[model samples]
Target: MRDSFDPSASEIETTTAEEGKTRKRPRPGERRLQILQVLAEMLQNPKGERVTTAALAAKIQVSEAALYRHFASKAQMFEGLISFIEQTVFGLINQINQKEESGLAQARGILQMLLFFAEKNPGMTRVLLGDALLQEDDRLQERITQVLDRVETSLKQALRIAQTQGGTWANVSQDEVSIRAAMLMSYVLGRWHRFARSGFKKLPTEASDISLRILLSE
Candidate 1:
């Protein structure tokens, strides 16, 4: 522990010397959230580089061992970010259900939000789109794929909504809706790839409105 900000990790341990009760460690959820928060902060690096465990520990003001106490592996710490992505995007999808009257608009709005979110979170885009998760454990990219699938699913649902409300439901089933959703998702993924490859100096939303006009247009 450092002299000034070296907060004791022992206080939250399982077997305290005095208590000896083996009371369970305080909430794992909170610690997990902190880990994810630190991971997000690490992603904000402008260089678009991979974040290391040592660097992450330094950012959180905790030792790498402390980070391990909460997460078994670096991959696990990334899973926490994956979980946040799922929760956040889906939560917003649920909210879109309440706010938007037309499914087409909901689909459009959701994609817009995803693009905007990625713009704000450069590091997260690397992870979400597999730009950052690549070359690590294979499973990490799979999890990010799941994140994309979830987004595609949400968009498909919105398309289904549009069919019913926007008079675009012309004999479309969920499968057809899913096809269109997947295409839209692929477009966004390509944009993300270009932006990341361009050192993040290239904005993904450049010419976005015209593109969305063509995509969502009849």
Candidate 2:
């Protein structure tokens, strides 16, 4: 029955975490977003040269120590980029799930989104393909692998439905449908990689309807 119950132990703990202690200020979630924005910008480079903390700091117009204030290490920054990639790509995939009536249409939408995402974010394409993550850390590459798996899984789901409807593909097993989905994903990645390597010149989906038909057929 004190003035404020002596600010209980839990309250004090929460206060310390919120306000920070001796090491450094807590990294705001928004700061993580900013760090990723900068990282994606770096990836747009065609040469895909190594991205150093110093260079990132310069691009962001902040000191390297400032970058560390939000991320523990440079590798964590790449992880941040991967997190954004997952959130964004999957969010679109979910929307297609809810919106599309035809499996073929959903498949088309997913491919369109993938290539369009690359076209919109040139720098992000480099990082997405691991041209930038190549020597940085193994974790970054693993994250990319997981991203591809999710996309492939979504594709298989849609294509399996398409086969059930007996359209372009008919009576496909999960295994065969899964293989076709993976192949489509591989095609998209190849297109994206070429776009990133060409410095965003070559597009992956200009005449994609015809190309997608070829993929859907074979």
Candidate 3:
């Protein structure tokens, strides 16, 4: 449940209270988005500490009850972030699958985008690496694992296509494709860790093209 500037979270309007005082409040859906945005911003910290609902409520300038008005609980807020990641990443994957022809190219593009997206959204990178969900509900971690598994499956599919099309591998079996896809996913995860651990100083895409070339060559 971590990431970047959401344009939609910008200040919308202020409403006058019954006492004739103007108070600022996020517009309807915007509050929910703002809550997620702040949660993500807090998670981007290099410490990778568990964020408590009290702290999250404080960050949003709202009472705990106010926070609950938008989300049932803190876990649900994390789920919101997870849902955002799944939709955003998979939507892009669908496009890559639709437009890309070469299996190798599809795999490469997916990996590159994975790193690029992380590089740009460091907070979300923390969630992707499970650094932000260490102490939260175990289910959040499982959801992240499932997302990565799907990514690996997509990679395996692309690799199998490459093998069928020829010029990608020499008699590589389906098991081997799974293995390599897992390895590629591992590499991406490692890069994400480095990016987060290095206080976001290290870019995930540093020499990424050359690195992918070497890895894919195997």
Output the better candidate (2/3) by lDDT.
Answer: 3
Per-residue lDDT tens digits for candidate 1, residues 178-208, read: 7889889998998888877877778888888
Question: Which residue runs of candidate 2 sit more than 4 Å off their true CA positions?
Answer: 1-30
- In the range 132-195, model 2's lDDT, one tens digit per residue, is 7887889889888888888988998899889877754776677888789889999899989889
Candidate 1 positional error at 106, Å: 0.9
lDDT of 1: 0.75
Model 3 lDDT tens row, 87-196: 88888888888989988889998999899889888889988988888878899999999999999898889898889887648588888988999999999999998999
| C-alpha lDDT of all candidate models, in order | 0.75, 0.77, 0.86
Best by lDDT, which number? 3
Q: Write down the TM-score of every candidate.
A: 0.77, 0.82, 0.91
Candidate ranking under TM-score, highest first, comes to 3, 2, 1
Whole-model lDDT for model 2 versus the true structure? 0.77
- In each prediction, how many residue pairs overlap at the backbone (N, C-alpha, C within less than 3 A)? 1, 1, 2
Query: Which lDDT value does model 2 have at 193?
Result: 80
Query: Which pairs clash in the backbone of model 2?
Result: 44-123
